[model samples]
Target: MERRIISAGFVQDALAALTRRGLDPAPALAAAGIASGNERVSNLQYGRMWLAITAMIEDEFFGLAARPMRPGSFNLLCQAVLHARTLEHALRRALSFLRVVLDDPAGELLQKDGLAEIVLTDRDRPRLAFAYRAYWLILMGVMCWLVGRRIPLMRVDFACAAPENRSDYHQFFGAPVHFDQPRSRLVFAAHYLSLTPIRSEKALQGFLRAAPANILIRYRHDQGLSARLRARLRATPPEDWPTLDRLAADLRLSPATLRRRLRAEGQSLSAIRDEIRQAQARIMLAEGRLKVAEIAARLGYAEPSAFHRAFLKWTGTSPAAYRTDKQG
Candidate 1:
């Protein structure tokens, strides 16, 4: 989660907006601890940069339009939706609240063909892909938080032209994304509408403190063995990573049975372990808070050279080279 795993396209888009507004993006980037020349920024860095930019412009919407969404608009919206009895009520109320505050991009919930769609419509200006991405992310994120799971997206449609990185859309929505559509919308199972909100006012406080960070990073706690395993791995320190046998025991399965289950799920324990380590390494390196040797040790590597070899194999670049390239 600490890694600079986000696509550089987002940063570029934000910078472009700053430039268009005749504002210097350097200060925001610096405040986020992001090197202006870097290709990508960590999620935390992006959140910081976003907050800084919004503060400077006094618009939480990032100057995507003429009218500014005041800085505390999101907080107010969350408060309004918090007392809803069901997910449907929460979304409908939240969207209604937003419509009153913002002049464009009003939202409506439509039900048809066993699917519930949250459609967002805006004044027909050339849309920034990043802006649309952010819009969809917030809506989907808040809904998921309410239902206590990652809602399986049935369809995601955008009004703008397809982005150059089309493949990324699939990963973002966990469903194929269609562009050049009539309006921006997210479709999912209608059943989710009746699901009660699992979050309470106490929980909302923590969510508000983190702001967009909790939403921007999509964490699926609902399905997928890979996601569950990834969550467990993330919760445990790299140095304390359990052995396959121990992991199986923890999951209440024999080692052989666990192996079979993993293979059936189209994954392997070793592969998942490697992924966790690589992700952690990338984040730590991006943060630049630890030395290479220190990171290697923290990741349970016996020697720095072993860590270097593993990193090179995983990333096709030496650790130092990867860090330098990403850090600019």
Candidate 2:
């Protein structure tokens, strides 16, 4: 599967946060392998820029909040919420944590009529849309990873003016983004709050090691070459996953063009295939109805031992142990 490349406007907006502070973004952008400002960027490059920016500014929130969010702020927040029994517990803790750290934009979790909303109340000036976007990314990113699935957003409302890349923001959030609204808020189903978090401690540790880069990947839209390939692969069984040539033909592109596009998106067919298999295996393990060997066979592993090692490589734990942990 190909990772979607973001618009040039996003690159500019992200870096603008630094430039507005009178800090040069050149060093960070260069460190992330970005050049001309108008060029589109891969998620990897953009994520790298985020790390460099945070490290340089010593603020994960781009110094938008009155109190600078120190380097380890997000890490501590994740660790604090890791043990929560359900999504609602985790979110409330997250909101509370933000309240203690940031002076403006108090966060509240409210539910009524089977819907949940995360509202950010700005005490004085409304925050930049990009800043609000980052906050949502952090919360929704964690929410999706914990639930082991994407929690669909109903709509995102922003009090700030829409930027030139409004459509890009819409795609990034995978939901409609309304600008110049009454307040900044995120809406979703209240029932999602009751679902238990599916990530294990070990898995979260591995996730934190990658940090914002991997976290950002969890929440982008199904766009571009990777999106098309992902749709095709998910529609077929593991055993029926097509070869590159076959997939290229199906996509109506020459094999060479397919290869080039995948490269640009920082993706490979084999890696995408592996990702699909890993996802299917994880879902099966979570359901707890299938035997390990049966699940292995369904995922195209002829031998259960091969499946065990593969699962270990993907999740940092053996299949049986992972299943046991999830059950407990």
Candidate 3:
């Protein structure tokens, strides 16, 4: 699967926040491998830039309406919730911790009518756009990490009026979103609250290192059958990939049924195969550990020319050119 990319508007927001505090964002942007003020950035670049900016300013919340969430506050927050018996307990504990740290805007988790609702409320009406985005993302990310599944959202309600980039929020939240509502809240199935936290301290050590990058992928297996199929393809080696008929058999469905299912999901077996192959090719090229011929063989391509053609088709450049661009 292709890695997610972030809109440059988010970086612009971060820059504005830094400028307000008399800080320079150029160095951080450079460190994050972004050379231009373009409209899109790879998710990895966004994560790097976000961490660098927050670290330089010593404020994890990026000086958004809330008090400066001091450096290391996120680690502390993660530690505080790591051992909860269930996601419900962990979520409440996390909200309580944030409330104590940032006072005015309080986080609440409520379960009623077979739905779990997570809300961020502020009687003082603090600057909410940035803060709300971060808080909701944090809550959803942490909850999903705890349960080892992407909890499908039913609806996301925002108290503030919709912004011009409202569609972006809908994409990120993966659900119906209502603006100009009485409160900012996320709604999902209540049963997720009962799922125990599957992460151990050891597991969390690696996860924390990845941080926001892990959370930003817009789609996950629970979102649809296509995502699940992509996950399966990703897990298997390219040389060992199953044929369409074999894959369908393994999935316990007929080839015709599988095709129909994938079509309904706006996907096809060939596209999924190509995505996985392209992703692998890029990774191998970026690593620079293998020659083009070797990489082609590993990807099950019978000839180097075929691999080169596919690479050009997928990336609009030759494999060698792509590698050189990435390495430089």
Candidate 4:
């Protein structure tokens, strides 16, 4: 399989954060084989690249402090958060506007009662393979810095069992860390919402709009495996219809292992394959050139009748009717 790249906007934010801390991020980036220059990075591509860079910087340079907050991005995000009308509104704005600052997969910020929470879901399975725990720490640290307060955290939650670093949680979050929970979360006092924003709306919007595409893509891609799998199917179609075994092999796992892993991730091979087929069939039908037989063959169906049945199941209409609907 081809290696995924990281978002340029995310890279820029990380670089900016590193620079603010008086550390040269170029070496870490170069160690990950990324360019230190300001070239645009596509959000649709570069997921692995960004993850690799993030891992490198966190392990080598930032360690526990490796979050967007260390750079000015978190402060900028806080400015937007401070400008909102209420704690709820502030968190909502932060969720909507802060995507450019961090390449986090779990991106929910919610407030209730007297507590505020930031929820992050790790999509990757085998629990600890991904560096989400480190990223979570970075997010909390940055948020604390942005509010300019050592805001006390109520608790921390994770889907996985406790790692060896359980002791460090208190130092970083200033709260207790809970493991074996349904999801990862950072709980805090609700009072942080009333603080005034230090940055102007115009400035915030400018930063969000001009954020590097690379980072945006990372956010989108990291959200789930279904999306990532669909993107892969589109980019590199096999010569024949790829079977579950084949696809799993390509992703570097046994068929049984893949099924188990996908199950853990709340997905199934059949669902993903059908999704890809339907998506491709729609695109082909829209082009209005290929005969039903050719489209069927391209999609790895051995017979046009089988393809037609599948199409009807997918769209609730036959292939011809679907095409007519699109053309009309």
- Highest TM-score: which candidate? 2
- List runs of model 2 lying over 4 Å from the truth: 1-4, 223-328
The 10 consecutive residues of candidate 4 with the worst lDDT sum are 212-221
Q: For candidate 2, which ten residues in a row score worst on lDDT?
A: 263-272
What TM-score does structure 4 among the candidates reach? Answer: 0.35
Residue 84 lDDT in candidate 2: 90
User: What TM-score do all the candidates reach, one by one?
Assistant: 0.67, 0.67, 0.67, 0.35
Residue by residue across 160-230, what tens digits does model 2's lDDT show? 88886357787777556899998999886565688788778898899788878766776664646876887
Candidate 4 Cα deviation (angstroms), residue 144: 3.2
Predicted candidate 3 versus true structure: per-residue lDDT over 171-256, tens digit per residue: 66656788888888888656557778878999889878988667655233234566777778778877788888997888899999
Question: Per-residue lDDT of 209-316 in model 1, one digit per residue for the tens?
Answer: 887766766432223565677679879888888888988888888999987866544457776677668767877888888999999999989999999998876656
- Once fitted onto the true fold, the runs of candidate 1 whose alpha carbons sit more than 4 angstroms away are 219-328
lDDT score, candidate 3, position 27? 84
Candidate 1 residue pairs that clash = 3-283
Span of 10 residues, lowest total lDDT, candidate 3: 216-225
Q: By lDDT, rank the candidates, best first.
A: 2, 3, 1, 4
